[model samples]
Target: MVRGVVRPHRVLSGSWGEVIASNLDYHRATFRWKCEGLSEAQLRRRAVPPSELTLLGLMRHLQGVERHWLQRTLAGTTPAFPPYKTYVTAAGDEWYDDSDPTPAREVYEDYVRACQESREVFARATADTARIVPNTEFGATDVRFVLEHVIEEYARHVGHADLLREAIDGSTGE
Candidate 1:
């Protein structure tokens, strides 16, 4: 089982950035917890039939999500890793492939790094309001929207990870 990562306590009263960061970190840790103790094969196993989702894929996807929202969207910086969408299958329905040969350990490590980078970006920001993206489908947007969207993305995927993990080995928890 994985160790060393701990979910942070809920911030009942704090600055807006502090509360959002805490919730985001909590969900990120939850996703990692769901995949803990699994072997590479287990991590790659398509536990959810008819769906290409795997623990390793989720790790890759979340890593991209964290970087995309914080580094690209919020900070307008180029992504430091491969775009997760580039791996779209011939079927064009999934971002991850069951046949991918990348080591699961590498995927996990990259995910951790992405999370750290996102946290650093957030911590360094002077204000979320001034960092705005213009002319989006959602119109002008700022880090507030980006942070909320990223947290929502994690919350949804963590639930998926919970189901997939339970299917893999009958394991279940928050």
Candidate 2:
């Protein structure tokens, strides 16, 4: 077997692809877990001015991402959950959230639920290299691309979340 290629009909990985995919999943899950236990106001508070990179907003954004990649792209289905257009801007305005102010409990519940749904979708597609759909950026895709991108996206926001949460009340770490 090639060093980076799968054994075919089985998945034993001395492979770059599988390794990266595994790491991606780890980081993505870590990002979600890190935001737990913060309040709604804390999660939604804009730490940096002119930037709405709140933990709640990140949750909503990641929900939209999961819908796009796993549902729309992979499953080829319409969004099962509501779209989070509240934080989306028309253009050049990445930070604009306008959702109803839910209690911390409610917000956390929704975010956690979304992550569960996404996990289901990811698990259903058996192959890491399964080509669910084409992405504009990644172009041709396997599940690996989706997994990696999700991790990348979440990692970026998690760093922001770390700072935001720390600024709120001095709590930190994953």
On the 0 to 100 scale, the lDDT of residue 95 in model 2 is 47
Q: Give a tens-digit lDDT track for model 2, residues 112-132.
A: 566566666654553546655
lDDT, candidate 2, equals 0.62
Clashing pairs in 2: none
Candidate 1 lDDT, tens digit per residue, 7-115? 7787878998778778888898888888888999899888988987888888888987877778767766776985444455667644755466777877888898998
Tell me how candidate 1 scores on lDDT.
0.78
Off by over 4 Å in 1: 83-86, 89-94, 135-139
TM-score of each: 0.87, 0.70
Model 1: C-alpha RMSD to truth?
2.6
**Residue 43, candidate 2: how far off, in angstroms?**
1.5
